[model samples]
Target chain A: MNEAEIIQKLQQGNEQAFRHLVENYQKRVVNTCYGLVQNTEDAEDIAQDVFVEVFRSIGSFRADAKLSTWLYRIAVNRSLNHIRDNKKRKWFQSFEDAVKEKKAGLLHYATENPGTELENLQRANILHEAISSLPENQRTAFTLNKYEELSYKEIAEIMDVSVASVESLIHRAKT
Target chain B: MNCNTLHTKMIFFLEGELPEREMEEIKIHLESCTDCAAFAEEMKKTLAVLETDKTPQLNPFFYTRVKARLEKQAEEKVVTQRIPVFARILQPAIFSVLLLAGIYTGIKIGQPAKINSDQSVYTENEMIPYLNEMEAEAIENFLME
Candidate 1:
């Protein structure tokens, strides 16, 4: 079916149409979540959540952009939220547990991450930490550019920012 | 280009996004300036390492899982909406009844004494004589007319 027809079907809450959407964009959503969260299980869980949200609120979607862009936007936002919540939960743990967690070392986080090569694991982990430490906009721009390979114009559209602003964010991220 | 300007363009230079003239200018500067060249190389290496394919692919049944979750959510929504209207408002309905009972009880216990005092004036035997005199005067005036 054409994009408009598919969207109409989705808005109508057609089960078959929803299944089609889930099948088509699942990989992209999952991959984007994985890229942001850096954990296999959490990415999968968040990907499922992204689709569930899409189904629940499909009618409310403004559809001003491509479906895939909106999906990426959701996936990125959700993955970051998952990370933020996890950090907060960890912070709320007892002092002894927090000390133990610190003793476990941050490198352990990378070792368990799926798709990380052992040869470059340390470097990659450090890079991940650096990206995480960056401000939200810079990290998002850098991720969309360096990993997703989205153009500055496309990233600008997805991020709802000017192309020049995206360029500056990526520049700041690099430095 | 100077080192400071070259620093701003290093990312584009590494990505080879600069215009031909500017590219040449930066290249010449990099050739002559060891510190800038080193900095550029370091930035390039950092970016290269940053570009690793670290995001894991989703499992084959990812769509199935998502579909199942959505179905479950939809089912819950349906169930919640199907709740009986009275059952949904049961808590508030019970609270309102208890509140009204308490107010009625409080009024019965705290009945005012001023209402009894008003009744005493209307029921007094002395008012009967005044009422009879007023009726007598009306009859006398009617007979005179």
Candidate 2:
């Protein structure tokens, strides 16, 4: 179904349609969260939270933009907030321990891999980690453009920045 | 097209964001200047690398978990929405009962007035000593009003 039909059904309390919507966008939301949080479990939790917020507030969603854009805006905002709050919580814990655990996990997976596909996956993971390390604004701009394939204008709108600023951010991100 | 201008617009050119005139200019520059051509190629390669870096697919259980959570939330909201009706009626009824009970209690705790030497109503004998001569006279005068 088209976005309008799906949204209309969702607003009418159709669970099947809601499930379809979840199924359709779950990967993108999860990926977006993963790009921000860099942990699979946290990303999953954040993605679930994003959908819950979307469902609760779907009634108020205006159709002025694409549903995907609207969903992305929600996903980005939630992911950034989650990261900010997670950083605060992390300050109370051992940052070194977390980093060691992550490196160990990545090393274990890398050692077990024998195929080129595994190598590519490892590289992608590294890139994602690099992307996550970027300042929040740059990371948000890059992820929205790179993963969502959003136009600079759409990204600027979602991020509440100028098109020129978005362009500069992506440029800086590339370098 | 100047190689300098084309070099500056390489980012936009790669994304196909340039106007037709500028695009034509860049295309012509790419045809002649090896350096600008290589620059465009390098930019394209970077974008290609980025393009290949796909967003990882989420685990299979992700959708199920999200759906379950959303359903649970929706169910909760439905239950919450149904609650206010009963609460609305119950709230006012409870408030009115409590208000009436309070008034009844206040009236029960209170007593009729008794007159002292000053002829002013007193709820208790302790209030008589606090009455001053002028105040007592003012009270007596006001009573006549």
Candidate 3:
């Protein structure tokens, strides 16, 4: 079905249309969340929330805005919220809890790739920590640009910022 | 270019965003300066993490899980909707019952006072006349004395 028709069907609460929407956008949504959260499981979980939100609130969606942009916005917001909520847990777990968690996480990664996964996982962890240290907007812009490979203009549209702001954020993030 | 200038432009150069001339200049500087070269190498490795940590694919069961969640949500919604409807109906009914009870209680409390006032009306009138007679008698005795 066409975009308008699909939206109409979704607004009408058609499960088929919902399934179609999920099929079309699921990977991108997960990838967007993954870019920010840097965890495959959390990314998928947040992506599910994103879809559920879209399904629940599809009636309020303005037709003028692209669905993909809305999806990305939700994914980004959800991932950031997840991070914020995790911050408390992280603070409390800064002791031996962190080490145990890291060990558990490393084991999880090791199962996927027996040999090189640990090194790559460690690199990814360091990179994620660095990205997490950045200001929220800079981190967001950089993540979208680097991980999702989105253009500055696209990031601007999703973030509702000027392209110049996105460029400046990314430059700051890189530096 | 000096190290400071090259350092500022290193990110843009690494991203291939700088102009060709500036890119060439930075490249020449990095070729000679070990410090700048090492920094550039580190930056490259950091940026490469994005490539190495490949974007994860959505699981095939993603839609199924979403569908299950949606269904569960819908079910909870039905239960939730039932409650508000009950509350919507119950709230005003309870308020109205309490209001009627209040009015009834008020009327009941007020009735005794009305009854008491009615019963005391004759006594008050009789007491006044008797008091006047006593005063009159006392005045007459005092006048005679």
Scored by DockQ, the top model is 3
- Chain B TM-score of every predicted model: 0.58, 0.39, 0.56
In candidate 1, what are the lDDT values of residues A21-104, reduced to their tens digit? 888877667767766666567778998998888887788888689887888888888988897898899778898996675445
Give candidate 3's whole-model lDDT: 0.84
Q: Model 3, B106-134: lDDT tens per residue? A: 98988854367776888777754345675
Residues A52-152, candidate 3, lDDT per residue (tens digit)? 99999999999877888889999999999999998888987767888887677666655644575555667766787787788888888988888788999
Best by TM-score: 3
Candidate 2 stretches greater than 4 Å from native: A104-126, B1-53, B71-145
Per-residue alpha-carbon lDDT of candidate 2 for residues A46-155, written as tens digits (9 for 90 to 100): 88898888788889988887887888788888889988897787788797987886787566434434353654555645665778689989999888777777799988
Which residue window of length 10 is worst by lDDT in model 1 chain A? A102-111
Residue A28, model 1, lDDT:
68
Return the TM-score for each candidate structure. 0.66, 0.59, 0.75
Which candidate number has the best lDDT?
3
Ranking by DockQ: 3, 1, 2
The CAPRI category of model 3 is acceptable
